[model samples]
Target: MRASLLLLAAVVTLWGAHWPIMKVGLAHVGPLWFNALRFLTGGLSLFLVVALLGRLRVPPRRDWPLLLSVGLGQMMLFGVLVMYALRHVPAGRSAVLAYTTTLWVTPLSVLILGETVSRRKVVGTVLGLAGIAVLFNPLTLDWSDRAVVVGNLILLVAALVWALCILHIRAYRGLSSTLELAPWQMLLAAVPVTGAALWIEGPHPGDGTLTFFLVAAYAGPLATGFCFWAVNQLTARLPAATFSNAMLAVPMSGILFSAAALGDLPSGPVLLGMAIILAGMATVVAAERR
Candidate 1:
């Protein structure tokens, strides 16, 4: 349990820190192009590792549907939305909004899996909505500014879709060799990312700077490849509620990292929203624990 907690902590920290690094990468690469290269590098590296370990094999036909769901919904769509949102959203706010996947998961679970929604989850959902309202500050929002509104909506949708994918994974009862299969999922998601990069956003704008290469290496190999493995491993070992609650640390870490690495301090409004969201999530966690 101690080792599991430590590993989970390490994984979240790595994931959180990657947000700023991604911001840096985007300055040099287009969203789709960056993700395509990142996924390809990460996926190919994992494939090599699995092959070297002699664990690589052809997945059964039965696995294809679930694999595609995860690859497309979780990786491809989620990654693309996040990358695009980061173009306009502040890193700290983006992290907080993205991690609302916790709130999304409960409703998705109830709807898709016929699970009962406790009163606490309902309260959590309401509070989560309130936080979003605060974050948006509707009274002052300019309807003409499409970027902020679109970015926030995209992040919310990304979080919801990712929640659905998590529930999908939980429903699959026979997922053996998740580590071995993960590379294939990454590669599957890479197809659309690569295609979109080629068709919609042709040619890299980067000047081949050392910073670009550094960020790409971190985002692709350490953050994507290693973190994916860690998430799967931890998910298999931990309780769902416990895992969700523990991952709250991720957005906190992201906020701090953004402040230090990217100088993205949370404003008064953002801080308020974050506090409310955390309280709501804590309520949900406490209810689950009970």
Candidate 2:
């Protein structure tokens, strides 16, 4: 249990830091190109590790659908949406909104997957939206400022789409090791992401600075590759509710990391939103435990 806790913490920290890390990388490369490069690098890194461990293999035919969903829905769509959103949204706020996918999952599961929705989850869902509303601050917000509104809405929709992907993953039952499928999923997602990059973003600039390379390395290898592997390791040891709840910390940590790394300080409303979001997430976790 202690080991699981530590592993969970590490995963949360890695994911949290990724928001700002990605922001840094994007400063040096186009969003679409950066995503393609990072995922391609991550995929190859995972392939190397899995191959060294003698666990790498092609996924079976039936598994392709699940893999495709993960690649398309979770990887390509989610990454592209959030990356574009991050251009206009603050790193901390973007993290907060994106993490709302967890909040969306329960209600979505109940509605689409026919799973039961507890009263607590309903309350949690309400609190989560309230947090978003508060952060949105409609009373003072200029409706004409399309950038901010569009950025926030994109994040919210991305979170919902991500929830769908999570449901797809949860519904899959398979004999192939997750590690084995992981590289393929990355590669599958890479094809479209790369294509979009070529068509929309053209090629990355041939000359990248040291800072760009450093940020790319962190985003690709540590954030994407190792973070995925670490979470998979901890998942089997931790309770589902505990794991989900632990993820609530990721965005909060993202706020702090962004403040330090990117000098992104949250405004009062943002802070309040973060608190409320955490409270909502707590309620959801408690309900799941019950």
Candidate 3:
């Protein structure tokens, strides 16, 4: 159990950094291509690892639908849309908004999975959102323009899709192991991401430099491939609250990634907002623990 928790914790940190890492890659590659390469390469890498481990088990025919659904919902829906949102907003703020999925996941579990929501979860949700709102306020959102409002709204939808995916994963019964499920889902999601990249970015994504290739490699093999493996295994063992709370690391991870790679430091509102968000997530997590 401790090992499982650590695996998920590692995933939380790696995935948290993903937003900033992908943002860096997007400087050269189209958002579509960036997602496409990450998943395609990531999925391939997972397949290779599972094959080497001899732990790969194909999902049963009955489970294929569920896995595919999860693939689209979690990977394609969350990945593609978040990329779109990132193009319009700052990566740090985008990281905060994307996690609204945690809030959405709480209600979803109740409605879809028939899970009971404790008062703690409810309060945690509110506090988390409050912190998110504080972070968003610095943007001084202008709804009059289509881009700003539309951008924020798009990110909200991305969060919803991801939240729904989390619920669906819990409901789906066919998964045999995280290793098998992680790769297959990536392969499934790769379909849409590649299709979108082709449609928007055209056949050629331009010749990437060494830096571009390096970032893409990290995103694919390390971040997407290994991270998914870790998440599947850990989430399978833990409660959603435990898994989601681990994600409190994401905002901090993104901030650090930005500071290190982008040569940027977080502003006062961002740091303040991140602190509040962590506190709120802690409240919810503590509530769940008790």
Which candidate leads the pack in TM-score? 3
C-alpha RMSD (angstroms) for model 2 = 2.9
Count of backbone clashes, every candidate in sequence: 0, 0, 0
Candidate 3: stretches off by over 4 Å: none
Q: Candidate 3 at 90: error in angstroms?
A: 0.8
When 1 and 2 are scored with lDDT, the better candidate is 1
Candidate 3, clashing residue pairs?
none
TM-score of each: 0.85, 0.86, 0.90
Task: Give the worst 10-residue stretch by lDDT in candidate 3.
Answer: 234-243
**Which pairs of residues collide in model 2?**
none
Model 3 Cα lDDT, one tens digit per residue, 38-88: 899999988888889998877788777668766888777878888888887
State the RMSD for candidate 3. Answer: 2.2
lDDT of 1 by residue, 1-290 (tens): 77887898798799989888888888888999888988898998899999999999777888887778778887889899999999988887777778777676656666776767678866766676567667556565456779988998898899888777777777776545678778988999898889889999986635589998898888887888888777767766654444555566677678779989988777788678767767876777677668
Query: For residues 55-116, what per-residue lDDT tens digits would candidate 2 score against the true structure?
Result: 88889887887788767877778888999998988787788778776666656666676766
Residue 85 CA error for candidate 1 (Å)? 1.5
Query: What residue runs in model 1 are displaced by over 4 Å at the alpha carbon?
Result: 114-143, 203-205, 268-290
Error of 1 at 130 (Å): 6.6
